[model samples]
Target: MQNQLIAFEGFDRVLNYGLDRLRCPSPVGVDRRIRLTQKVASIEHINATMFRVVLDSAIWIEDEDKPAIIASLIAQLHAAPDTT
Candidate 1:
């Protein structure tokens, strides 16, 4: 299985995106929004400091699309800094 790792400044944003996409309700969303997706399977850090988001099971993401999804997330995260 492949793992995707990401990081962000704020934790709330990351949590929200992950919960929303993963279709899992979490209490953490109520407090602070995660900024990014951090470690994956506690193996790779992805050099992230803010938030850690990982799409492990196939339920969360398709095996074929994993790479694309990861790339997109990374691109979006990098673009965010420029937009703001």
Candidate 2:
């Protein structure tokens, strides 16, 4: 993965984005959003099945919204083939 600095809610961390999925810095404390999507079954079924979008834990920490953006990007990439 590349060392790409992505800004979160108020923090910054290196986020790695791949063709199929994204690896986001894990959320700290009693987190719920990013932490909950650790499971394949936890993400939206469409994204999981079609785009194979995934969210996994990492050594870094950041805001939860970053993953949502990643997922959107992945879906757009996945859909690009038929659109253009």
The number of clashing residue pairs in model 1 is 16
- TM-score for each predicted model, relative to the true structure: 0.19, 0.19
Model 2, position 68, has a per-residue lDDT of 31
**Candidate 1, which ten residues in sequence have the lowest lDDT sum?**
70-79
lDDT of 1 by residue, 4-75 (tens): 333454333443333323433222323332323333342233444343344333222222222222221221
| Regions of model 1 farther than 4 Å from truth | 1-10, 15-40, 43-49, 60-84
Candidate 1 Cα deviation (angstroms), residue 23: 20
lDDT of candidates 1 onward, in order:
0.31, 0.33
lDDT of 2 by residue, 1-84 (tens): 312322123222223334344444433455543322232323333442133334442333355444332332221113322333
Q: Which of the numbered candidates is closest to the native, going by highest lDDT?
A: 2
Instruction: Name the runs in model 2 displaced over 4 angstroms.
Output: 2-52, 60-76, 81-84
